[model samples]
Target: MALPVLVLAVRWVMMIMGSDPRAVGLSAEPIDYTINYLGLWAIRFLILSLAITPLRTWARWSWLAPLRRPLGLWAFACALLHLSVYFLLDQLGSFSLLWESVAKHPFILLGMAAFTLLLPLALTSTRGAIRRIGARRWQALHRLVYLAAIFTAIHFILRVKGFQPEPWIYAGVAAVLLLVRALPTAWVRRA
Candidate 1:
């Protein structure tokens, strides 16, 4: 599952390790590509993570239920890597540059806000944490993932110019996932 991200990291490192990095093709284009790739994977895993409840409740796929935690964790990991690549490689590890980006591009702030929301959820995802926080409270708190996904959708939309179907499709998927989760489970059950 993590091997693709590992491979991407290795390729990114290899491309940027030398002084003549541009000669080796370490340029804005590849950085943008990598950033896009990371963001896509983050969104993908996030949707998958959010889908488990609906699947378990409506489809009664108890066997697939255990995957929820791991999927959410991977979503967080990919999102973190997405932020890291932007902050580290794209901005050259400059906080000022990042802030400047936030000022210049609203999407950066949206992305950061999404990440901020995910932090607590990631921190308290464990069984022990749930025990400490109480399952009801933990479940309530984890619902923040919906807000995070919304912010991510806006960020993605702003990142692109004019109109594109891709970001909107992801946003629509996020919306449908939320809708399904909100539905009365007793009203609809399929075998």
Candidate 2:
């Protein structure tokens, strides 16, 4: 948590300081880099949160269960930041431009779809909300994360102009995580 926050802060500071010799590549297009950085962290955190269940099941480490909530929240936070950068910096708070981008870019639409799905999960992350929803219902609702992850990966892959290994790698990671979740408990245990 602290690490992510610290990295975000440093990135923000570097973006502001633009033209620093050390920040060459990032300084050239700070907003774009910041957006990408935030999105990457969001995906990484989402994957980490999803991994908690499998880790707990395989390692028998119950303590890891408590971490799922925070990781999920962090993913949402990073996603929010990513959207903010796009809206505020890239789109200049123009709804017309935003709508145009959404219409013109399939990746933007996919990213928006992923964020929409994440909203409910983030809102229901609280213990009180979980209790109100009932455990079974809450679990079912949270299963939307798989769809969100898929959308996110597609959004990422489609955004790049040329073939890049980074986006593909993230998509691959998402695929593996989803596969792990889809596997039967007995099958997982036998492995």
Candidate 3:
């Protein structure tokens, strides 16, 4: 599960360090490439995490629920990497630039909001943390991933130059996954 995340992180590191400045499937600019690549992946993992429970029910695969933890953590890592690249490379480690971006760009604010929401979820995604927090409270807290995904979707769409179907497709997937959760259990189980 972590293998893909590890490889992607390494590749991003290499890109940032000039070892591989060309982004294969993303923007030509390294900073934009890193930021966009990581941002999209962050949202992907987040939506995948959100899909676990619903998939478990729909498929009658109880084992699927355990997959959410690692996916959520990966999503959190991607989000952290995305923000780190922007702050470190794009902002040149300047707080003033970060603040300026936040002020001037609503997309940046949305991205920050999504990251803020995922922080606690990732931090507490462990058996020990679950035990300490109590199962019920922990479940409630982790539900923030859904909101995080929404914010990420919005951030992704807004960060681009104009309306594009790709970001909209992501948003659509997030919405469908969320809708699945709101569905009646009996109805979902029948599907």
TM per candidate comes to: 0.87, 0.90, 0.88
Q: Against the true structure, whose lDDT is highest? A: 2
Best model per TM-score:
2
Per-residue lDDT, model 2, residue 53, is 90
Predicted candidate 1 versus true structure: per-residue lDDT over 59-152, tens digit per residue = 8888888888888888889899899989999899999999998888778999998998999999998899999999999989998999999999
Worst 10 residues of 3 by lDDT: 19-28
lDDT of 3 by residue, 1-191 (tens): 56655666677677667764555333457568767777878888888888888888888778887788888888898889889988998999999999998888888898998999998987898899999999999989988888888889999888777667998998999999998889999987776
Task: Give residue 132's lDDT in candidate 1 (0 to 100).
Answer: 100
**What TM-score number comes out for model 1?**
0.87
Going through the candidates in the order shown, the clash numbers are: 0, 0, 0
Q: For model 3, which pairs clash?
A: none
Candidate 3, position 40, lDDT: 77
- Candidate lDDT scores, in order, read 0.85, 0.87, 0.83
> What's the best-to-worst order under lDDT?
2, 1, 3
Tell me the lDDT of candidate 1: 0.85
Give, for candidate 2, the lowest lDDT window spanning 10 residues.
19-28
Model 3 spans > 4 angstroms off: 3-5, 9-20, 23-28
